[model samples]
Target: MLYDLIILGGGAAGIFAAINAKLTHPTANVLLLEKNAVLLTKVRISGGGRCNVTHACFEPKQLIKNYPRGEKELLGPFHVFGPADTIKWFESKGVLFKTEADGRIFPQTDQSETIIQALLQEAHGLAVLIKLTEHIEILENHASYFTLRTKKEIYQTTNLLLATGSSRQGYQWAEQLGHTIQKPVPSLFTFNVPASSLKHLSGVSIHPVRLQILGTKLFQEGPILITHFGFSGPAILKLSAWGSKYLHEQNYQTRLMINWVALSKEETFVKLQEAKTHFPHKTLLQKNLFDLPKNLWKTFLEILGISYKKRLIEISLQQLKNLAQKLTGDRYQVEGKTTHKQEFVTCGGVTLKEVDFKTMQSKICPRLFFAGEILDIDGITGGFNFQNAWTTGYIAGKSSL
Candidate 1:
């Protein structure tokens, strides 16, 4: 059957596009194809199953900063359908949302199923046909329509939207359609410090910490979580997104510098010296000047070769300097990386320059569009990526119709 619009991939972007296309033109025929048995798999596992729908960042300019790859290209598209629109769109569908303190927006029910059901219901209500476990084996772009051959059958569509979300098949299809494919690389991952002495301190998190990738200008300041594998948290994930390409080039073997205190070395030293002067009788084990967790502080003292029983007065000037240095610039060798939970993001796909962000349409192929991680657009953790999917999906859907 010839469809007015055929959206490949049943993830957030594809589903959203299908719904929007039908909404824009009620008579238009839309079909969604998913290779997986289930739809919205990523949404089901996002935010530890809560489903981070979008960020509370409403301003397009401010919202663009969260994206490392599509920052510049997404500016115009976000201005059209930004996070505010996403919230309103969901709310219109009776899905209440709550924004967390960190600006991540999730369904008030706190269940990813709520989000999945909302999208599915909207699509069903609009008469959008959804086929599961259907993989398109071949795609041919004719002068007017596109031919897609699946293992089970063949279909044709006038407008095709690819929201495959970093799947290699999507890249191959886009390349086949005369579009340039950027080399895909993993993004939003955690560092794996195999030899880290702080492995026992897993689950310890520090707020307002600074993390810098040594030998590069990549850095991020936020909360850092120490996992048994390595470092996984806002700061590390943000740094990983920004440094995805560089880390991939380095083979995921790089040096990470952590500022536990988020303070300069000299500032940390001064603070330590003040602690010595004011609380000279306080023992190092009992007094943590930086407000770090007790276990983490104890581990730091051990790593610094300083006795926990040592009083502030007993700390020599050199020892104080060393402690300050350690707090401000603790270095770790990242031997590898682990995907940040199940929300695996990629840093590359269809090159941004080759796509028209204004309408999310392919510049090289007429009636062809892209959305979600299938394009070279990935944001750091905290709902920015979803915003991209929604924005691009909305534009693609509306424009295609």
Candidate 2:
């Protein structure tokens, strides 16, 4: 059967495109194809199962800033259907969304299944045909219709929307269709410091710490979480997203300068001196002057070779200087990168310059469109990535019809 539009992939962007396409043009025959038996796998696993739907940033101007790669390309798309539109779209479909303090938006039910079911129900209501486990191995774009050949069958469509995300198959399709793939790389990952001093402090979190990639201007300041492997959290993920290309070129080996105190060198020194003066008899481990975690403070003292039992008054001037310097700026070597749970995002895809953001249609292929991670658009951690999916999906679907 010839379909009016065929959407590749059953992920967030594909599903959204199917629903919206059927919504705007109910008479059009739409088919969604996916290799996986289950649809919305990433959405189901996102936000640790809560499904971070989108961010709370309603303004398109501010929302675009979170994306390092497609900031300029997504401006027009976000202006048309930003986070607010995503919230309203889901809510109108009976799924209520709530925003957290960090600006991540999730279903009030806090279950990814809610989102999955809503999209599925909408697609069903719109009569969007879905075929699972149908991996298209070859796509032939004809002058009038596109031919999609899977292992088992061949389907034809007049219009096609490729939302295959970062899958190699998707990149191959884009390349075959005369588009350039930007060499996919991992984004929003955590730094892997195998021999990090803070490895022992797994599960410890430091707030408002400044992190700078040594030798580069890339930096981020936020809460940093110490894991068994190394560091993860807002700051590390932000830095990872912003420096993904640089780190990729360096073979994922780099050094980081962390400011645990988040203060100037002079301020850190003065603060340490003031603490020593006010609590002369107190041991170095007795108080966490920098408000750092108790265990982390103890670890720092031990690393400085300062005896935990050493009274503040007993600390020599040289030791004080060492403590202040370490507190303000400590260097750690990052040996590798690790994927963050449920937050894995790709840093590259089909070059954005080849697509028209106004309708998410490809300039190279008139009847073809792109959306989601399939484009060279990725955002930092939180709900920004999903928002990109919704924005592009909506436009691609609406305009494809």
lDDT of 2 by residue, 119-180 (tens): 99999988999999998878999998899998799999999999998899999999999999
Using alpha carbons, what is the TM-score of model 1? 0.98
Q: Which runs of model 1 end up more than 4 angstroms from their true locations?
A: none
RMSD to the hidden true structure, all candidates:
1.2, 1.3
| Clash number for candidate 2 | 0
Task: Please give the lDDT score for candidate 1.
Answer: 0.91
Off by over 4 Å in 2: 340-343
lDDT of each: 0.91, 0.91
lDDT for model 2 comes to 0.91
